[model samples]
Target chain A: MLEFILARGNYWVIVALMMTGLYISFSAQNLIKRLVGLSVFQTSVFLFYITLGKVAGGTAPILIGEDLAGHHGAGHEEDAAHGTAAAGHEAPVETPAAPHVETEPVVEVDPETGEPIADPTAIDPAAELAPDAVDPGHSDIPPLQGEDASLMGEPLEDGVTETSDYVLSGHDGAADALHQAAESSLHSVYSNPLPHVLILTAIVVGVATLAVGLALIVRIREAYGTIEADEVRNIDIDVALEEEEAEDAAAEGAA
Target chain B: MNPDHHVILRVVAKTLIPLITLYAFYVQFHGDYSPGGGFQAGVIFAVGIILYALIFGVSSALRLIPPSFTRGLAAAGVLLYAGVGIWALFGGGNYLEYGALLDEPEGGHHGQHIGIILIELGVLFGVAGSMLTIFYAFAGRVAEISDEDW
Candidate 1:
């Protein structure tokens, strides 16, 4: 029980919100307050679905590029090729720098020797040092580059990338995940797109329902002179009783 | 209603309204690459207009966008959405196949891009129109309810 509670705390909070919204919508006297409650309930449901779709370290559903590796392959190859070409010379590469090229850019081509210089500022001290101690250049290199590169490529989260298939084919495990994520750092993602697509339609439908409900409430207020449910019910009951009495009188008079 | 003046609010609103609309368009167009698309953008767009209505008075807002136009827009938006699907059908593909939007089904992602944009545009119109219409309906009733009724 403790393990379950600890693992799924967000679910508990969502339930609480859902219950509060349901209670308010069902029990509130004022029509507008009820609508507000309904809105709250709708919002909570949205949150629930969003939360469900979230992975431990996932990006949004948007596909930055279809062939994630190839997208950055061209850039990396160009940089490497430029570095090799300029090995004998001392001139900066003329490629339009990646949009995400940071201020203290990492793995930058050195201006003096025109060699790739990994910036110390961009590297995490812990990740860099820890890996070097166990295996100097093999295992630690990729993960460290992954971590730094992921952070460097966050600007593409806004938009303006090539379109491709949204669903990424599953890879093996942590290393593959890290590699894929690091390679296409711009489109780093772990979240499912299915939920986002489903919710897109639901949101519009939800708004339509809210609009119709509001319209009904307005009409009700105009007819009964009150939006309170109890008041409206009482008026309806009185009208029913008056009709019954009039019908009975008419029957007696005809007899 | 009492005539009031708040220079700060008016100035701030003036600045924010254009920014909000701009952001909404950004979200709409950039949605394929980001987390937002038509629904979210439309709501944000409607919110911008709604803010204008609240600040400048419903009468002025309604004058800016008549209720009749909103009704027409709502229907037109649905038609636009359906039209895309019908167009696809005529193109010899399943309804809303999207790949059919392009002349060459084997071409590339351009057809899908076109299809998504059309649907999103439809959604933008539908959502924006209905939201504004609903706001108008609610605000229109204010005159009928006297101050004492509250």
Candidate 2:
């Protein structure tokens, strides 16, 4: 989308404005007009920076966490602990446990009689329990907590649950999280010293240039009782001719 | 002052000059995330003020920003920039290396921010002062030489 905008109209406008400003700055004899042109030219660069920093669906690089509103957080010690735990081992506790008993019953119920009727296809209980029986009284296994119940709310077919569903369902919350992440990344990248340093240098150079330019203008105005460049130039030519004539007369007098 | 010129152009120029300068500071402070910094924004802001001087005459603008003060400001800005780097150097780090100043070998990123801000402020001062100086020089010349310098 940003590419489209730049390509379609913004790019041309920026270029045109920059060129126009440069042309005015160079061609115009008036100092004020030249400054105006320089400003226009500078504005184009500003627009370029703004355009380059643009990111689609990206928010301002501000950390909005409760602890640091609009500040980026550095790496924490807890992150290292988590990393160690993840790298150390594949703990059995991490896997979802199989259900102890089957939820579906084999018996068919008659709708009219409201009675359970034994089906001929029902397997013997002993045979069914031989291979898949799970002990319910295992002391080592802790009872399931709220975490287990929450996981259970998901589809039962797959022993493992899809975390994506939970995140996807929370559209606004997920977007906020993503936005925060993007913002922090932007902060990290933009917070570097290089650009700031460059800008500082540019400003100093710009100031010095402006100062020198102003000094020149002052000298010009003093030389001719007018700030106008054309008037100054004419005065300079007249002065030069007067000096030349004086030198010629002096040489002739010496001869 | 010509009331008509003051009414139309001066008012707008006055409002824009400060507004742009304030915006430049905002950009410098928030540069860690935004598309602005001390230098670029500072130049724009200084240019804005120069525009004000151009449109409303230098005397009016000089009332707000005196020439003598701006020269000091320019030097002060350079001092600020060098101060940060020197502080870092004194802290046992290489020049311009901000991490040493904080005594946190690992907090280099944080130091960079501090250093950047210092340098940016320096740039802002230099640009604003110099730009104003330019305006002053030209305007002063116009004042002294032109029949209608006022």
Candidate 3:
């Protein structure tokens, strides 16, 4: 439980921020104070999303073409070796160093043209070319491999580009430790793009709401002569009481 | 507001306003590549104008940008945004389908860029105009109430 809490400390901070903002928004008597609390609440929510999007050691999602090219070259050799091994080249199948990678799904190929179909399930070639490896500085580890090219209906070198490429692919025994590190970096650690995009729209909407709210407050102040919530409530209550009393008096006269 | 105001403040404000305006435009255009976009740029532009109004009376600011014009510009901005979507629909694509605007297949990417720029410009105009209008409405009433009344 301690480890779980420690691992998710960011969530705790988010909860604290949310609770503080909520408390202030509900309990604050001043209308402006309440608005401030609302803004604080919005800010906390933004922080929550941004925190959720953070990868442990991941860089910004933007890809550099030069880096991808470099990774692409390194990946090709590993892919070829894996292809040959899978084709019964008598190469050692198991690497002593690297953890065994479950064979990934092969790309479907059209038999007529001997070309790979654009499989949506395949990680984008661009994304595959991306140094998705967590430690970008350490280039010594080989690219992770996709299925052997021979396994697909077409030749690996001609049709398969991204799927066959992997870090430390053939040198399973030699690069096993690095492969595990890369594997850890590949899966659980990446940021989700959805929240980032969603929050962009949310922020604009939030600002629009804030602007309208402030405008309404200004109009309210002009009509009531005070912005205090207590004062405004009292004024409204007095007007309601006057209406009720007038209605009662009118009813009595009618009777 | 006075012609004989503190020389330093007047000079500093004069220097800063142009820079702020330039930065707002930069943010507007550079938004595609960077962190800022139409909403941010609009707010910055409004802030620059509001700062001017604070240093030099509201009347001076109003003279620069009349409230009537601001109101119209706000509506125009919204119309522009909607117009782009309509234009795309008329071009035989779904609403706001930027690719449909590309006459040539090779221009598909460029067409999307054009659509984004147009909408962002609309957002800029709407946000800046409305913000200024709101400021004008609020400031115009200051004469009726004295500071001590608060």
Q: List the candidate 1 regions with Cα displacement exceeding 4 Å.
A: A57-189, B1-4, B142-145
Q: For each candidate, give its TM-score against the true structure.
A: 0.63, 0.45, 0.66
Pick by DockQ: 1 or 3, better one = 3
Candidate 1 chain B least-lDDT 10 residues: B103-112
Give the per-residue lDDT digits (tens) of candidate 3, residues B31-111.
755777788888889889988888887888999988998898888889988888988777666677665555436324555
- What are the per-residue Cα lDDT tens digits for candidate 2 across B9-93? 7777767877877887787777655667766666777787778777877787788788887777778887888888899888776
Count of backbone collisions in candidate 3:
12
Best by DockQ: 3
Name the TM-score of candidate 3: 0.66
- Please name the candidate that would achieve the greatest TM-score relative to the true structure: 3
Residue by residue across B12-70, what tens digits does model 1's lDDT show?
A: 99999999999999999987556788777878999998998888888888898899988
RMSD of each: 15.6, 21.8, 14.1
Off by over 4 Å in 2: A1-211, A214-218, A225-255, B2-21, B44-57, B140-142, B147-150
Clash pairs of candidate 1? none
Kept native contacts, as fractions per model, are 0.14, 0.23, 0.00
Q: Which 10 successive residues of model 1 chain A have the least lDDT summed?
A: A156-165
lDDT of each: 0.59, 0.50, 0.59
Interface RMSD of each: 15.6, 11.7, 14.9
